[model samples]
Target: MKNLIRTFALVTALLLPVAAAHATVLTETGLAESKVAASETYRLNVPTEKAVATTQVRLVIPAGVAVTRFQVMPGFTRTVETNADGLVTEVTWRGRIAPMEYARFFFQARNPEQAGTLSWKVYQTYADGSVVAWDDTDPDNTPASKTTVK
Candidate 1:
């Protein structure tokens, strides 16, 4: 009985990280089924699960969505890239998210006039210089957060 219990404990410990890796790392709120062509404030929730601090976050604005403003976050510098049409296509925030901590960034944007899903592709960089692209279909890694417009 002692040996069996020890084996079970070891298995549980080994599986914890796997379970965590599959968990959602980036969560988006306030954009679900928003009205078409309507402006809304959206929030992206970022959590750092690494031992090292998170150094940077980049969000790729989906096509047809026009981002107009950003709420400045303390301790972070914000940058925006625009397309030829002068619409913001990318927004990046440079800050430090300590180990086991999280941060929320807010922005206002006009939803697409047509009804469809918008997939928000985000990339997270750690202090160690490693990056994770949240554009995958696999849940084991980070996946793109999506919202629909009606």
Candidate 2:
């Protein structure tokens, strides 16, 4: 019996990492519009699971999209980086974020002479340096999101 219990425990431990890799929260909403013009602002709202004094928040701007501006409200520090192509590949916000607290991130950009769904992964960093990626199909990662252009 002792040997059997030990074996089961080992198996569970081995599977734990795999489970964590799969452990992601995704807060995604359907795109409200199929067409967004070149001149407009798009918005998305995301919340933290176990709110951490946020150390940083990173947003990736995919190819074919131009980011003109990124804004964070009252209590956050932000950084924006553009790649050689002059497109924003990363936008990071640094600050404290309490668990269950939500923040809105907005950006103005123009589509790169093209039109379609523009998608990218976003990551949230906790005060402890732990990171939560808003990816995968986990509903917990799902956040309020929208697209707009005029």
Candidate 3:
């Protein structure tokens, strides 16, 4: 009994930090690995991590990826910024994600022809007027989501 109890404690101590480091408020799915030049649909899962509701979310499209379409999320308004060549550079969703609730936004885009990593920067704003930028390169810092083109 003593040995089992000690092992359990040791395992918990070793795994807690790893779990914490990977805790993300905004997670993305789909398009993890896709063929070059393929049109893929991706989903961004945003959770209200704070006590207040999330009021807005902005996503900065990385170079080489051209976002062509977006899915309408209920209660949210979608907006975009275009470049000179008529390409989308940024996408923003305005709505209220109540405390302890989550929302998912979907979009379709064409992957670049070249094989590389596309890092997506996202900013989450709370109703209290605070913003969380998911642009870090480190995992523990709420880094932006990345997709690899094969």
For each candidate, the alpha-carbon lDDT, in order, equals: 0.81, 0.59, 0.80
- In candidate 1, stretches whose alpha carbon ends up further than 4 angstroms from where it belongs are 1-31, 137-140
**What is the per-residue lDDT of model 2 for residues 85-136, given as tens digits with 9 covering 90 to 100?**
7677888876665665666667666655555645556677777778766653
Ranking by TM-score: 3, 1, 2
Alpha-carbon lDDT of model 1: 0.81
Estimate the TM-score of every prediction. 0.79, 0.63, 0.81
- True-structure Cα RMSD, model 3: 3.8
Q: In lDDT terms, which candidate is top? A: 1
RMSD of each: 4.8, 9.3, 3.8
- Candidate 1 residue-wise lDDT at 57: 93
TM-score preference between candidates 1 and 2, better one? 1
Question: Which clashing pairs does model 3 show?
Answer: none
Kindly list the per-residue Cα lDDT of model 1 for residues 1-150, writing each as its tens digit: 999999999999998765554213222454356778988888877778789999999999989999988888999999999999999999899989998788889888888889998888888899999988877656445767778778
Model 1 root mean square deviation, Cα atoms? 4.8
- Model 3 accuracy (lDDT, Cα): 0.80
